[model samples]
Target chain A: QQPVQSPQAVILREGEDAVINCSSSKALYSVHWYRQKHGEAPVFLMILLKGGEQKGHDKISASFNEKKQQSSLYLTASQLSYSGTYFCGTEPGDYKLSFGAGTTVTVRA
Target chain B: NAGVTQTPKFRILKIGQSMTLQCAQDMNHNYMYWYRQDPGMGLKLIYYSVGAGITDKGEVPNGYNVSRSTTEDFPLRLELAAPSQTSVYFCASRGTGGSGEYYEQYFGPGTRLTVT
Candidate 1:
Protein backbone atom coordinates (compact mmCIF):
# COMPACT_ATOMS: atom_id res chain seq x y z
CA GLN A 1 0.00 0.00 0.00
CA GLN A 2 1.08 3.61 -0.66
CA PRO A 3 2.04 5.77 2.25
CA VAL A 4 0.37 9.11 2.98
CA GLN A 5 2.28 12.40 3.24
CA SER A 6 1.14 15.43 5.14
CA PRO A 7 1.35 19.13 4.17
CA GLN A 8 1.00 18.42 0.48
CA ALA A 9 2.82 21.68 -0.22
CA VAL A 10 4.72 24.23 1.80
CA ILE A 11 6.65 27.45 1.18
CA LEU A 12 9.44 28.54 3.42
CA ARG A 13 11.95 31.34 3.57
CA GLU A 14 15.64 30.93 4.06
CA GLY A 15 16.63 30.30 7.65
CA GLU A 16 13.18 28.89 8.36
CA ASP A 17 12.39 25.30 9.27
CA ALA A 18 9.84 22.77 8.08
CA VAL A 19 8.81 19.19 8.55
CA ILE A 20 7.36 16.54 6.27
CA ASN A 21 5.50 13.52 7.61
CA CYS A 22 4.80 10.11 6.12
CA SER A 23 2.42 7.47 7.41
CA SER A 24 1.73 3.96 6.25
CA SER A 25 -1.19 1.71 7.02
CA LYS A 26 0.97 -1.36 7.14
CA ALA A 27 4.01 -2.01 9.22
CA LEU A 28 7.24 -0.85 7.64
CA TYR A 29 10.64 -2.41 7.74
CA SER A 30 12.33 0.82 6.77
CA VAL A 31 11.65 4.34 5.59
CA HIS A 32 13.71 6.17 2.97
CA TRP A 33 13.56 9.86 2.18
CA TYR A 34 14.40 11.35 -1.21
CA ARG A 35 14.22 14.77 -2.83
CA GLN A 36 13.67 15.54 -6.46
CA LYS A 37 14.22 18.88 -8.10
CA HIS A 38 12.11 19.97 -11.04
CA GLY A 39 12.93 17.96 -14.13
CA GLU A 40 15.48 15.88 -12.27
CA ALA A 41 15.69 12.44 -10.78
CA PRO A 42 15.15 11.81 -7.11
CA VAL A 43 18.19 12.07 -4.80
CA PHE A 44 18.59 10.04 -1.65
CA LEU A 45 18.51 11.98 1.58
CA MET A 46 18.42 9.53 4.47
CA ILE A 47 17.02 6.23 5.60
CA LEU A 48 15.64 5.10 8.95
CA LEU A 49 15.50 1.41 9.62
CA LYS A 50 13.30 -0.38 12.12
CA GLY A 51 14.07 -0.52 15.87
CA GLY A 52 13.16 3.18 16.17
CA GLU A 53 16.34 4.59 14.72
CA GLN A 54 17.19 8.13 13.63
CA LYS A 55 19.61 9.38 10.96
CA GLY A 56 20.76 12.81 9.86
CA HIS A 57 22.59 14.63 7.13
CA ASP A 58 24.06 18.15 7.28
CA LYS A 59 20.74 19.90 8.05
CA ILE A 60 18.27 17.14 7.28
CA SER A 61 17.24 14.51 9.75
CA ALA A 62 14.65 11.73 9.81
CA SER A 63 13.15 9.49 12.44
CA PHE A 64 11.21 6.30 12.03
CA ASN A 65 8.61 5.21 14.57
CA GLU A 66 8.06 1.54 14.08
CA LYS A 67 5.02 1.32 16.32
CA LYS A 68 3.18 4.08 14.52
CA GLN A 69 4.32 2.97 11.10
CA GLN A 70 5.35 6.50 10.28
CA SER A 71 8.37 8.74 9.74
CA SER A 72 9.09 12.45 9.82
CA LEU A 73 11.74 14.54 8.03
CA TYR A 74 13.09 17.72 9.55
CA LEU A 75 14.75 20.51 7.60
CA THR A 76 16.52 23.12 9.70
CA ALA A 77 17.40 26.58 8.42
CA SER A 78 16.24 25.74 4.98
CA GLN A 79 18.12 26.88 1.91
CA LEU A 80 16.96 27.77 -1.58
CA SER A 81 18.41 24.54 -2.89
CA TYR A 82 16.07 22.71 -0.55
CA SER A 83 13.15 23.50 -2.82
CA GLY A 84 11.90 20.31 -4.37
CA THR A 85 9.40 17.48 -4.06
CA TYR A 86 10.17 15.22 -1.13
CA PHE A 87 9.08 11.61 -1.16
CA CYS A 88 9.14 8.97 1.55
CA GLY A 89 9.50 5.44 0.33
CA THR A 90 8.43 2.59 2.60
CA GLU A 91 9.55 -0.99 2.60
CA PRO A 92 7.04 -3.48 3.96
CA GLY A 93 8.90 -6.61 3.03
CA ASP A 94 12.43 -7.50 2.04
CA TYR A 95 12.44 -6.74 -1.65
CA LYS A 96 10.10 -3.92 -2.70
CA LEU A 97 10.14 -0.23 -1.87
CA SER A 98 6.96 1.81 -2.35
CA PHE A 99 6.86 5.61 -2.37
CA GLY A 100 4.41 8.08 -0.94
CA ALA A 101 2.38 10.68 -2.81
CA GLY A 102 5.15 13.24 -2.10
CA THR A 103 5.29 16.69 -0.55
CA THR A 104 6.24 19.72 -2.61
CA VAL A 105 8.43 22.24 -0.84
CA THR A 106 9.52 25.66 -2.06
CA VAL A 107 12.24 27.53 -0.22
CA ARG A 108 12.60 31.14 -1.14
CA ALA A 109 15.52 33.53 -0.77
CA ASN B 1 30.22 5.80 -11.46
CA ALA B 2 27.23 6.01 -13.77
CA GLY B 3 25.03 4.54 -11.04
CA VAL B 4 21.86 3.78 -12.97
CA THR B 5 21.08 4.69 -16.57
CA GLN B 6 17.79 4.44 -18.51
CA THR B 7 17.39 4.84 -22.24
CA PRO B 8 14.89 6.94 -24.26
CA LYS B 9 14.22 9.63 -21.74
CA PHE B 10 10.92 10.37 -23.43
CA ARG B 11 8.71 8.60 -25.91
CA ILE B 12 5.21 8.90 -27.39
CA LEU B 13 3.44 5.79 -28.52
CA LYS B 14 0.21 5.00 -30.33
CA ILE B 15 -2.33 2.60 -28.94
CA GLY B 16 -1.59 -1.11 -29.37
CA GLN B 17 2.10 -0.44 -29.93
CA SER B 18 4.77 -2.14 -27.89
CA MET B 19 8.07 -0.97 -26.39
CA THR B 20 10.68 -1.85 -23.86
CA LEU B 21 12.26 0.34 -21.19
CA GLN B 22 15.87 -0.50 -20.56
CA CYS B 23 17.61 -0.10 -17.20
CA ALA B 24 21.30 -0.64 -16.46
CA GLN B 25 23.40 -0.09 -13.38
CA ASP B 26 27.15 -0.14 -12.87
CA MET B 27 27.10 -0.47 -9.10
CA ASN B 28 26.69 -4.24 -9.42
CA HIS B 29 23.91 -4.13 -6.87
CA ASN B 30 22.08 -7.38 -6.28
CA TYR B 31 18.59 -5.87 -6.21
CA MET B 32 16.87 -3.90 -9.00
CA TYR B 33 13.32 -2.51 -9.30
CA TRP B 34 10.95 -0.92 -11.78
CA TYR B 35 8.29 1.61 -10.83
CA ARG B 36 5.73 3.81 -12.54
CA GLN B 37 4.56 7.23 -11.39
CA ASP B 38 1.26 8.76 -12.38
CA PRO B 39 0.17 12.33 -11.82
CA GLY B 40 -0.65 13.00 -8.18
CA MET B 41 0.11 9.41 -7.30
CA GLY B 42 3.03 7.74 -5.60
CA LEU B 43 5.23 5.34 -7.52
CA LYS B 44 3.91 1.79 -7.86
CA LEU B 45 6.28 -1.10 -8.28
CA ILE B 46 5.99 -2.99 -11.53
CA TYR B 47 8.63 -5.65 -11.12
CA TYR B 48 11.90 -6.43 -9.40
CA SER B 49 14.88 -8.74 -9.57
CA VAL B 50 17.00 -10.01 -6.72
CA GLY B 51 19.77 -11.32 -8.93
CA ALA B 52 20.53 -12.40 -12.49
CA GLY B 53 17.76 -14.69 -13.79
CA ILE B 54 15.69 -14.09 -10.66
CA THR B 55 12.64 -11.93 -11.17
CA ASP B 56 9.40 -11.34 -9.30
CA LYS B 57 6.13 -9.46 -9.72
CA GLY B 58 5.37 -6.38 -7.72
CA GLU B 59 2.23 -4.43 -6.79
CA VAL B 60 1.32 -3.43 -10.32
CA PRO B 61 2.73 -6.07 -12.63
CA ASN B 62 -0.13 -6.56 -15.04
CA GLY B 63 0.32 -5.16 -18.56
CA TYR B 64 4.08 -5.29 -18.01
CA ASN B 65 6.76 -7.92 -18.21
CA VAL B 66 10.37 -7.94 -17.05
CA SER B 67 13.55 -9.94 -17.49
CA ARG B 68 16.84 -10.10 -15.63
CA SER B 69 19.33 -11.64 -17.99
CA THR B 70 22.38 -10.31 -16.16
CA THR B 71 23.28 -8.57 -12.95
CA GLU B 72 23.62 -5.23 -14.71
CA ASP B 73 20.38 -5.11 -16.67
CA PHE B 74 16.63 -5.32 -15.94
CA PRO B 75 14.28 -4.41 -18.74
CA LEU B 76 10.53 -3.73 -18.57
CA ARG B 77 8.40 -4.71 -21.55
CA LEU B 78 5.02 -3.27 -22.43
CA GLU B 79 3.33 -5.78 -24.67
CA LEU B 80 0.47 -3.53 -25.81
CA ALA B 81 0.56 0.11 -24.92
CA ALA B 82 -2.54 1.78 -23.59
CA PRO B 83 -3.46 5.27 -22.49
CA SER B 84 -3.50 4.06 -18.92
CA GLN B 85 0.15 3.09 -19.22
CA THR B 86 1.24 6.67 -19.81
CA SER B 87 3.46 7.73 -16.97
CA VAL B 88 7.04 8.22 -15.87
CA TYR B 89 9.02 5.05 -15.24
CA PHE B 90 11.99 4.80 -12.92
CA CYS B 91 14.61 2.10 -12.40
CA ALA B 92 16.41 1.64 -9.12
CA SER B 93 19.09 -0.59 -7.60
CA ARG B 94 20.25 -1.33 -4.08
CA GLY B 95 22.81 -3.46 -2.30
CA THR B 96 21.85 -6.57 -0.36
CA GLY B 97 22.38 -7.88 3.22
CA GLY B 98 22.72 -5.07 5.74
CA SER B 99 20.92 -6.58 8.71
CA GLY B 100 17.44 -5.47 7.60
CA GLU B 101 18.78 -1.97 7.09
CA TYR B 102 17.54 0.08 4.20
CA TYR B 103 20.23 0.66 1.64
CA GLU B 104 20.03 3.84 -0.37
CA GLN B 105 18.73 3.15 -3.84
CA TYR B 106 20.20 4.73 -6.95
CA PHE B 107 17.53 5.88 -9.41
CA GLY B 108 17.71 6.68 -13.09
CA PRO B 109 16.43 9.92 -14.59
CA GLY B 110 13.24 8.07 -15.63
CA THR B 111 11.50 7.57 -18.92
CA ARG B 112 8.39 9.60 -19.71
CA LEU B 113 5.93 7.63 -21.79
CA THR B 114 2.81 9.08 -23.35
CA VAL B 115 0.42 6.76 -25.13
CA THR B 116 -1.89 8.52 -27.49
Candidate 2:
Protein backbone atom coordinates (compact mmCIF):
# COMPACT_ATOMS: atom_id res chain seq x y z
CA GLN A 1 0.00 0.00 0.00
CA GLN A 2 1.08 3.61 -0.54
CA PRO A 3 2.38 5.49 2.46
CA VAL A 4 0.83 8.79 3.60
CA GLN A 5 2.91 11.91 4.04
CA SER A 6 1.95 15.01 5.94
CA PRO A 7 2.19 18.64 4.78
CA GLN A 8 2.10 18.30 1.02
CA ALA A 9 4.42 21.27 0.82
CA VAL A 10 6.62 23.26 3.17
CA ILE A 11 8.50 26.56 2.97
CA LEU A 12 11.58 27.27 5.04
CA ARG A 13 14.16 30.00 5.32
CA GLU A 14 17.87 29.44 5.50
CA GLY A 15 18.97 27.95 8.82
CA GLU A 16 15.37 27.01 9.63
CA ASP A 17 14.22 23.52 10.55
CA ALA A 18 11.44 21.35 9.17
CA VAL A 19 10.09 17.84 9.50
CA ILE A 20 8.31 15.52 7.09
CA ASN A 21 6.50 12.41 8.21
CA CYS A 22 5.40 9.27 6.40
CA SER A 23 3.04 6.66 7.73
CA SER A 24 2.02 3.30 6.39
CA SER A 25 -1.02 1.26 7.31
CA LYS A 26 0.87 -1.98 7.01
CA ALA A 27 3.99 -2.96 8.83
CA LEU A 28 7.22 -1.89 7.18
CA TYR A 29 10.58 -3.57 7.14
CA SER A 30 12.48 -0.53 5.94
CA VAL A 31 11.93 3.08 5.00
CA HIS A 32 13.97 4.83 2.34
CA TRP A 33 14.25 8.57 1.91
CA TYR A 34 14.98 10.21 -1.43
CA ARG A 35 15.12 13.74 -2.77
CA GLN A 36 14.41 14.80 -6.34
CA LYS A 37 15.26 18.13 -7.86
CA HIS A 38 13.41 19.49 -10.86
CA GLY A 39 13.96 17.27 -13.93
CA GLU A 40 16.25 14.84 -12.19
CA ALA A 41 16.14 11.34 -10.87
CA PRO A 42 15.43 10.85 -7.20
CA VAL A 43 18.61 10.45 -5.21
CA PHE A 44 18.84 8.23 -2.19
CA LEU A 45 19.39 10.11 1.02
CA MET A 46 19.40 7.37 3.62
CA ILE A 47 17.70 4.15 4.64
CA LEU A 48 16.31 3.21 8.03
CA LEU A 49 16.09 -0.51 8.59
CA LYS A 50 16.19 -1.49 12.23
CA GLY A 51 13.63 0.18 14.40
CA GLY A 52 14.75 3.16 16.46
CA GLU A 53 17.87 3.76 14.40
CA GLN A 54 18.36 7.37 13.40
CA LYS A 55 20.60 8.23 10.47
CA GLY A 56 22.01 11.68 9.88
CA HIS A 57 23.69 13.46 6.99
CA ASP A 58 25.09 16.94 7.20
CA LYS A 59 21.99 18.77 8.53
CA ILE A 60 19.44 16.10 7.63
CA SER A 61 18.39 13.07 9.61
CA ALA A 62 15.68 10.42 9.64
CA SER A 63 14.02 8.20 12.20
CA PHE A 64 12.07 5.02 11.70
CA ASN A 65 9.56 3.48 14.07
CA GLU A 66 8.80 -0.13 13.32
CA LYS A 67 6.01 -0.36 15.86
CA LYS A 68 4.23 2.68 14.49
CA GLN A 69 4.96 1.82 10.88
CA GLN A 70 6.12 5.35 10.26
CA SER A 71 9.22 7.42 9.56
CA SER A 72 10.23 11.05 9.79
CA LEU A 73 12.84 13.14 7.95
CA TYR A 74 14.37 16.05 9.82
CA LEU A 75 16.07 18.92 8.05
CA THR A 76 18.08 21.31 10.19
CA ALA A 77 19.40 24.67 9.12
CA SER A 78 17.88 24.26 5.73
CA GLN A 79 19.71 25.72 2.75
CA LEU A 80 18.49 26.94 -0.60
CA SER A 81 20.14 23.91 -2.17
CA TYR A 82 17.88 21.76 -0.02
CA SER A 83 14.81 22.80 -1.97
CA GLY A 84 13.31 19.74 -3.62
CA THR A 85 10.57 17.15 -3.37
CA TYR A 86 11.22 14.59 -0.68
CA PHE A 87 9.70 11.14 -0.85
CA CYS A 88 9.54 8.36 1.69
CA GLY A 89 9.49 4.90 0.18
CA THR A 90 8.44 2.04 2.40
CA GLU A 91 9.11 -1.64 1.99
CA PRO A 92 6.02 -3.31 3.33
CA GLY A 93 6.50 -6.48 1.38
CA ASP A 94 9.47 -8.43 0.12
CA TYR A 95 11.52 -7.09 -2.76
CA LYS A 96 9.28 -4.09 -3.45
CA LEU A 97 9.20 -0.49 -2.32
CA SER A 98 6.24 1.85 -2.55
CA PHE A 99 6.62 5.62 -2.31
CA GLY A 100 4.47 8.28 -0.70
CA ALA A 101 2.78 11.13 -2.53
CA GLY A 102 5.85 13.22 -1.60
CA THR A 103 6.39 16.50 0.30
CA THR A 104 7.78 19.52 -1.48
CA VAL A 105 10.29 21.52 0.55
CA THR A 106 11.29 24.97 -0.66
CA VAL A 107 14.18 26.56 1.20
CA ARG A 108 14.74 30.22 0.53
CA ALA A 109 17.27 32.80 1.58
CA ASN B 1 31.14 1.57 -13.15
CA ALA B 2 27.71 2.50 -14.46
CA GLY B 3 25.10 1.55 -11.88
CA VAL B 4 21.94 1.67 -13.95
CA THR B 5 21.34 3.09 -17.40
CA GLN B 6 18.15 3.81 -19.36
CA THR B 7 17.89 4.59 -23.05
CA PRO B 8 16.01 7.20 -25.10
CA LYS B 9 16.20 10.09 -22.66
CA PHE B 10 13.26 11.62 -24.49
CA ARG B 11 10.80 10.25 -27.03
CA ILE B 12 7.63 11.44 -28.72
CA LEU B 13 5.25 8.78 -29.93
CA LYS B 14 1.97 8.84 -31.78
CA ILE B 15 -1.08 7.12 -30.42
CA GLY B 16 -1.09 3.35 -31.11
CA GLN B 17 2.64 3.34 -31.61
CA SER B 18 4.79 0.85 -29.79
CA MET B 19 8.18 1.29 -28.19
CA THR B 20 10.46 -0.22 -25.63
CA LEU B 21 12.35 1.48 -22.81
CA GLN B 22 15.63 -0.29 -22.31
CA CYS B 23 17.43 -0.64 -18.99
CA ALA B 24 20.73 -2.21 -18.04
CA GLN B 25 22.80 -2.36 -14.89
CA ASP B 26 26.45 -3.15 -14.48
CA MET B 27 26.24 -3.68 -10.72
CA ASN B 28 25.33 -7.34 -11.30
CA HIS B 29 22.24 -6.79 -9.20
CA ASN B 30 19.67 -9.57 -9.06
CA TYR B 31 16.71 -7.26 -8.75
CA MET B 32 15.47 -4.67 -11.24
CA TYR B 33 12.39 -2.47 -11.28
CA TRP B 34 10.47 -0.16 -13.57
CA TYR B 35 8.56 2.84 -12.25
CA ARG B 36 6.68 5.76 -13.74
CA GLN B 37 6.26 9.21 -12.23
CA ASP B 38 3.60 11.62 -13.28
CA PRO B 39 3.92 15.35 -13.01
CA GLY B 40 4.22 16.35 -9.36
CA MET B 41 3.38 12.85 -8.15
CA GLY B 42 5.22 9.99 -6.55
CA LEU B 43 6.49 7.08 -8.62
CA LYS B 44 4.26 4.10 -9.26
CA LEU B 45 5.78 0.72 -9.96
CA ILE B 46 5.15 -0.75 -13.39
CA TYR B 47 7.05 -4.03 -13.18
CA TYR B 48 9.99 -5.71 -11.50
CA SER B 49 12.24 -8.72 -11.83
CA VAL B 50 14.01 -10.58 -9.12
CA GLY B 51 16.27 -12.53 -11.43
CA ALA B 52 16.78 -13.40 -15.02
CA GLY B 53 13.55 -14.75 -16.58
CA ILE B 54 11.59 -13.86 -13.48
CA THR B 55 9.24 -10.91 -13.80
CA ASP B 56 6.17 -9.73 -11.91
CA LYS B 57 3.55 -7.05 -12.25
CA GLY B 58 3.50 -4.04 -9.97
CA GLU B 59 0.89 -1.53 -8.85
CA VAL B 60 0.38 0.23 -12.20
CA PRO B 61 1.23 -2.46 -14.73
CA ASN B 62 -1.57 -1.77 -17.12
CA GLY B 63 -0.60 -0.68 -20.62
CA TYR B 64 2.92 -1.91 -19.98
CA ASN B 65 4.88 -5.11 -20.36
CA VAL B 66 8.34 -6.09 -19.15
CA SER B 67 10.88 -8.79 -19.88
CA ARG B 68 13.92 -9.95 -17.98
CA SER B 69 15.94 -11.90 -20.45
CA THR B 70 19.28 -11.43 -18.71
CA THR B 71 20.55 -10.64 -15.26
CA GLU B 72 21.87 -7.29 -16.44
CA ASP B 73 18.90 -6.16 -18.52
CA PHE B 74 15.22 -5.48 -17.93
CA PRO B 75 13.20 -3.67 -20.52
CA LEU B 76 9.71 -2.18 -20.42
CA ARG B 77 7.57 -2.38 -23.54
CA LEU B 78 4.60 -0.25 -24.38
CA GLU B 79 2.68 -2.27 -26.97
CA LEU B 80 0.32 0.54 -27.83
CA ALA B 81 1.10 4.00 -26.60
CA ALA B 82 -1.59 6.18 -25.12
CA PRO B 83 -1.76 9.64 -23.65
CA SER B 84 -2.01 8.10 -20.21
CA GLN B 85 1.32 6.35 -20.75
CA THR B 86 3.05 9.69 -21.08
CA SER B 87 5.28 10.20 -18.07
CA VAL B 88 8.85 9.94 -16.85
CA TYR B 89 10.04 6.36 -16.53
CA PHE B 90 12.78 5.25 -14.20
CA CYS B 91 14.77 2.05 -13.91
CA ALA B 92 16.32 0.83 -10.69
CA SER B 93 18.21 -2.18 -9.41
CA ARG B 94 19.16 -3.72 -6.09
CA GLY B 95 20.82 -6.80 -4.71
CA THR B 96 18.98 -9.86 -3.48
CA GLY B 97 16.70 -9.61 -0.46
CA GLY B 98 16.59 -11.94 2.53
CA SER B 99 18.39 -10.41 5.43
CA GLY B 100 16.56 -7.69 7.33
CA GLU B 101 18.81 -5.01 5.94
CA TYR B 102 17.92 -2.14 3.66
CA TYR B 103 19.51 -2.31 0.23
CA GLU B 104 20.00 0.92 -1.60
CA GLN B 105 18.39 1.21 -5.03
CA TYR B 106 20.28 2.97 -7.80
CA PHE B 107 17.99 4.75 -10.25
CA GLY B 108 18.51 5.84 -13.83
CA PRO B 109 18.08 9.40 -15.01
CA GLY B 110 14.71 8.36 -16.48
CA THR B 111 13.06 8.54 -19.87
CA ARG B 112 10.54 11.21 -20.78
CA LEU B 113 7.84 9.76 -23.03
CA THR B 114 5.21 11.83 -24.75
CA VAL B 115 2.29 10.32 -26.62
CA THR B 116 0.33 12.51 -28.97
Question: Using DockQ as the measure, which candidate wins?
Answer: 2
lDDT of 2 by residue, A40-74 (tens): 99999999985679999999999999999989999
Writing each residue's lDDT as its tens digit, candidate 1 over A1-109 gives: 7899998999999999999999999988889999988777889998888888898899999999999999999999999999999999998767678888899999998
Residues B3-116, candidate 2, lDDT per residue (tens digit)? 899999999999999999999999999989999999999999999999999999999999999999899999999988999999999999998656665588999999999999
Which CAPRI tier for candidate 2?
Answer: high
Off by over 4 Å in 2: none
Q: What lDDT does the true structure give each of the candidates? A: 0.91, 0.93
Cα deviation in Å at residue B93, candidate 1?
A: 0.6
- Alpha-carbon DockQ of candidate 1: 0.82
Q: What share of the true interface contacts does candidate 1 keep?
A: 0.88
Each model's DockQ score? 0.82, 0.88
lDDT computed for candidate 2 = 0.93
- Each candidate: how many clashes? 0, 0
